[model samples]
Target: MNVNHSNNKITETACKITDEICLPDSDLPRIVIIGGGFAGLALVEKLKHQEVQVVLLDKNNFHQFQPLLYQVATSALEPDSIVFPFRKQINGYKNVFFRLAEVEEIQADSNTIMTNKGSVSYDYLVLATGTTTNFFGMDSVAKNSLGMKDIRDSLNIRHMMLQNLEQAAITCDDDERDALTNFVIVGGGPAGVEMAGALAEFCKYILPKDYPEYPSSIMNIYLIEAIDDLLSTMSDKASSKTLKYLEDLNVKVLLNEAVSNYDGNEVTTKSGKTILAKNLIWTAGVKGQFPKGIDKKHVVKDNRIKTGSFLMVEGSKNIFAIGDIAAVISKKTPKGHPQVAQTAIQQGKWLGNSLLKIIKNESPKPFEYKDKGSLATVGKRKAVADLGKMKFAGYFAWLLWSIVHLMSISGFRNKLMVGFNWAVSYFTYEKSNRLIIRNFKPTSSQTKESGQYES
Candidate 1:
């Protein structure tokens, strides 16, 4: 991908060189970005017409809206609602290409990236591989716990919840029925809270309609957070409101609690209490999925890379890390910024502008985080919002959360479909899905590497 900067007023020499550059050779500077999550996707869009030929590599062909993935897992929305095709998104852009491959490792000495398909060489590399759910080095939990990171995880959870309900209704053994009806969520973050709430809502509304033979109150949804409060990143008012909302929806909120051990049928907590829950959903924490070549010393808490103020990795100029994979150094943020989509998007845009400055030989400015706002919805018509200098709760906040997420959805069709579903679900206390297709398997040895395949 050779790019020639031609001045039209120059002589024939410049045009001929430009014409010679029109044909791609081995000389073109290639920019290979990994992971089609928020950071890499945003970077490619911002670098559309640049000189560097951008190769965006990701395991899946679609870019997922992770914030709403829990809803999809809970069956409040469809699979297509939270995913967008990567190549179709960049089809009109002339400079970027998308490759579907699982990155095995990074070979920084030769500027090479190793993938399952083959090896790719890059003049410049940007890693946005993001994070994976951390089970605290517990092999049994990692093996037996269901997560909500991608589309497959969401569908798996959906299948698990629905199937468990059906099993509870049919099983004659009391112990088996009790296990099927009980659900345990092992984190207090937004993912855990939202998932727990959605499961509770399924019990209050959908469960009753689908299983008239069984009592809806028998379906137990438990949320266990290690900290003293839920949504600790948000305002105290928002946290209290969220707790109240979850309680209102009949979700048992267990704060200052942690998981000890969990077999398939029972979960023992750190507090010496045991719950017989067949479905153990883990959202406890996430660790960065950084490629191998970056210095191990740069890995901070949460396995994020230590990035300079300009979003460049320390001791490296052209190499950059952003999104959930990169951690900015700041005394104010000792643990790094929250692993959120907004942070990734902001870092990506800033890095894009900085790249332009690098091309023009100009000084790049440092990045400053903007404290926009935070929000979490518990159940229908209940949510909490924490905007800087302003905080709201209940109906208005829930309405705002709905609109913001709807607008944030990638495609127009997705937004419309989600909006339609929300309207219908609100009017009629019903979920579109009540059929239990299959029982959930915690983890299969043969896992689909990406969301391109369905279980």
Candidate 2:
């Protein structure tokens, strides 16, 4: 395999070859990875000390723990506690290199990728590039609502939520204060359910103490889902218990309703009901995100690239797509695996080993996802879990959820900080990180479009 290198570092691409970016010339095959998400990171770990030269590229310099992003939005945990620097994460790996750049196009024919910085070729190209928020073609909803797919979006939610509460506290008009305090969270998935519970906790514990001038009763938290129940992916018992938990927390649960549009100040439902809420945290859906140059025929529903049983991109030999961007159809999984962290991690690790096997001219194994169960935490001592054979709900499940997430987060410092914060919040029932460090005002277009995660 040939790579365009100048001065043993990346420079620039000229005439479909190398550009400004340069790397050390080596006889080993070069594997270029697009995206630094869970899948990409897993691949990096699996490829450590391998013969091939690896290049990891991402739009952001840091990898944020997406699961805990809701905590940041709710002021339960600080942003730094969940995000770790990518460079530092791979500090001692000499064969691996990380670059900060946005991929603009994929030249499959030439085994080259064009980024904002330049172009580079890969012997084997892996796309672990994950998903972006799906607005469902609702331009108004996309333009007006806030999404929770990234750290920036969580920060924006934090700022906007606190700012609105502050404004509500000083407002004399009851209706205006109501609108400012009314928080509408669309989508009844884990993020929406957990976020609603957290906001309700804020109203019960934080708001009463922090905003003594305003009555906490006016702070309405709504959890809206289009389906018949919350956490539709979970078992019926789990969903029923979850609804009970949310109701017990006094969160208004609206089921069997879809949000049709949002005009910054109002959320209109498909049933023609209008909710006057300044904050609409959309956790509805996400679609695969990739650059141009791939044939449209290879793209499947939700913008995911279709992959063969071996996880190779449908029409390409040396190219593979994994994580949320890949739709690997089989008899067992006709649509695809659920877009979750476990799916991505499993795919990455399997692909990493498979590549080595293929390099040795040995047969690669077909991908199989082992479902390790699912967990969702609602509020203090309220959670649900589906362990396949067994389904449980309540305090024990919540504890399990906490422990799993605490262990899953990156870095000892981050884990320590998050644990300490959770401990403090659990005992005191007050959050100190409510201070709006950065003021965020949503634009007419993207509200939390910072390239780290979707807003």
lDDT (0 to 1) per candidate: 0.79, 0.86
lDDT of 1 at 50: 72
The C-alpha TM-scores of every prediction are: 0.91, 0.95
Query: Residue by residue across 227-331, what tens digits does model 1's lDDT show?
Result: 999998999998999999899888999999889898788898889989998988888887788657888888888788899788888877678888888888788
Question: What is the TM-score of candidate 1?
Answer: 0.91
How do the residues 1-455 of candidate 2 rate in per-residue lDDT, one tens digit apiece?
Answer: 44554323333333345484566556678888888888888898888778777899898988889998888999888889999998999997766888888888988888888989988788999988888888898988888888888888888899999999999978898878888999999999999999999999988998888888977898999999998999998999899999999999999999999999999889999999898999898899888888888789999899998998788998788998988889998889989898888899899899999998988889997999999999999988899999988999999999999999999888999999989998988888868567877777888656434445211
Question: Which residue pairs of candidate 1 clash?
Answer: 1-28
Over 4 Å off in model 2, which ranges?
1-18, 445-455
**Highest TM-score, which number?**
2
| lDDT, model 1 | 0.79
Of the candidates shown, which would achieve the greatest lDDT relative to the real structure? 2
Q: For candidate 2, what is the TM-score?
A: 0.95
